[model samples]
Target: MPEFAISADPIFGTYALWVGTLLAIAGVILFVLGTLLKRDVSQVWLTYRGWLIMIPTLFGTVMLGRTASVLGVAALSVVSFKEFARATGLYKDWWHTCTVYLGIAGLAIATLLPDPTTGANGWHGLFRTMPVYVIALLMIIPVIRNKTDGQLQQVSLSIVGFAYMGWMFGHLGFLANSPHFHGYVAYLIFAVEINDIAAFTFGKAFGKHQLRSNVSPSKTVEGALGALAVAMALPWVLHFSFPHFGTTELILTGLIVGIGGQLGDLTLSFIKRDLGVKDMGQSIPGHGGFLDRVDSLIIVGPLFFHMDRWFHGI
Candidate 1:
């Protein structure tokens, strides 16, 4: 019950403790910095507010048990895809959007609902092949419409939306079945957020060379390296949460998150650039939308999940 121990107490190990302490520390820092800059503390607090809303929902469900955690991850997938569909104008295609909705729900069911292979757990073999089957369905559905106006575009968009959001995010939900899911899932979420803060902090302090001036101008080579280094070392601090993770596994997983996070950010930049939009949507005040905030976690989910699966046999 060490996993559930976090939700039970606010000061247990680094899980709840780190979350609450970090949230408090960041709020104070942002407030002071905002005062110094003559800015609205509430406006600055908006970013922290997002965390206030997300962390409990994320960690809370996980603490409730595997069913709740899987449902939580699946719910996030649907919402994230909804934002993607809206940004790309694919939501107007109701039938296509329905396909994505169904695909994601089906993926969630494949994980949560009873199955012959996994009994009460997710069936990994089906998840591995769901993309292919879903892709076929997307392509075939458009043909039934017999409309060539935006045939290829809509079909491709639907495929990308489902595959990226549903398949990749599904990996996160299935991690509930891992040996130490409490720690693995917690680290993935916590460290990825830390990675973002590190990148931004380092970028501001010592950033000179743009890592991707065209895609994400704010990112810098120095910031990326600094974030990577910090993320790689952070696992040691939380290693107690994941006692089975070897030193090498922890380091490699950290690198996976660091690099995958940057790629995830760039992937969204490409999307926004292609769509001729600034932010995906204004769902979270200053934080754009659910998709914007979670883009990094999306890629890292599958990468970390598969790596852990490979090394430890999920």
Candidate 2:
């Protein structure tokens, strides 16, 4: 039998039971809700709510391990970058779209390949290969361009779109490979979800001052504080429950991750406002799109990665 089966903590067993129950319940509810309502739920609600269910479920199933989680993250990056490119009106050529997708596919495959035994250098080899793929696409842009007006604008947008959505999200693999993978992933999810939940609950109850009506009308100062409070409180709770994370460390991690999560939300909102769209896409019934759900994670992952490295000596 596997060692995990005989572990005293029953970590896997307990997690499976709870996760299965929740997913079954959620699946039924979503099905019923969709049928009864006969109308799709808000994208924001669907995206966040789905992740609230899916992330933990995946974690419990052992599918949320470093390798699997990073692959999921990379897949999301591809979707988001594709949407972003379309929104920004970049890559008019079919060839350009194909090229970008090909590069993304290559990166995704690289993620699933067995980790090289050459230590850090092996990882570096993977990273180096990604740029070469990207460069190949970049090199072909000139060949595809048909001397259209504002050529520079199109190329610039394409580059920025890829870098922001693809390159940045690819860093998830790097973070997953870090020493503090467990802590970092946990902290990232906790911070992002807690902050969003706290903000919404607080804003609804006692949001007198608007934070940004232009971008996100519902955001408020009260909600922001509420988020910060919960963000700060999580560390203390973790300390008491786990006894492994220290008080000072938790507090600092909470503050950084919480603030970063909020900023990410705001940034995404700004993008939506500029595009004059309500949600990113309709992939998830109530949720807008995968990008909408993982917007905060995009920022939180990198921030938490570096912070964990600094504090936990990872």
- Clash totals for all candidate models: 0, 5
Encode model 2's per-residue lDDT on 1-314: one tens digit a residue: 11122143343344445546866786667666677776574553465476676666656433345556567666777788777766666645555556666666666666555557743311535653676667557656766675656656655655655555666566665565654454455545655777898999999999999998898888999999999899888867544323455666677678776787787788889988998877777776666676787787767665665565566533
* Pairs with backbone N, CA or C atoms under 3 Å apart (clashes), candidate 2: 43-287, 43-288, 46-286, 46-287, 47-287
User: Each model's C-alpha lDDT?
Assistant: 0.81, 0.65
Give the true-structure RMSD of model 1: 2.7
Model 2: residue 150 alpha-carbon error in angstroms:
3.5
Model 1, 189-259: lDDT tens per residue? 78888899899999999999999888888899999999999888887877776778887888888788889
Please give the lDDT score for candidate 2. 0.65
- TM for every model, in the order presented, reads 0.91, 0.75
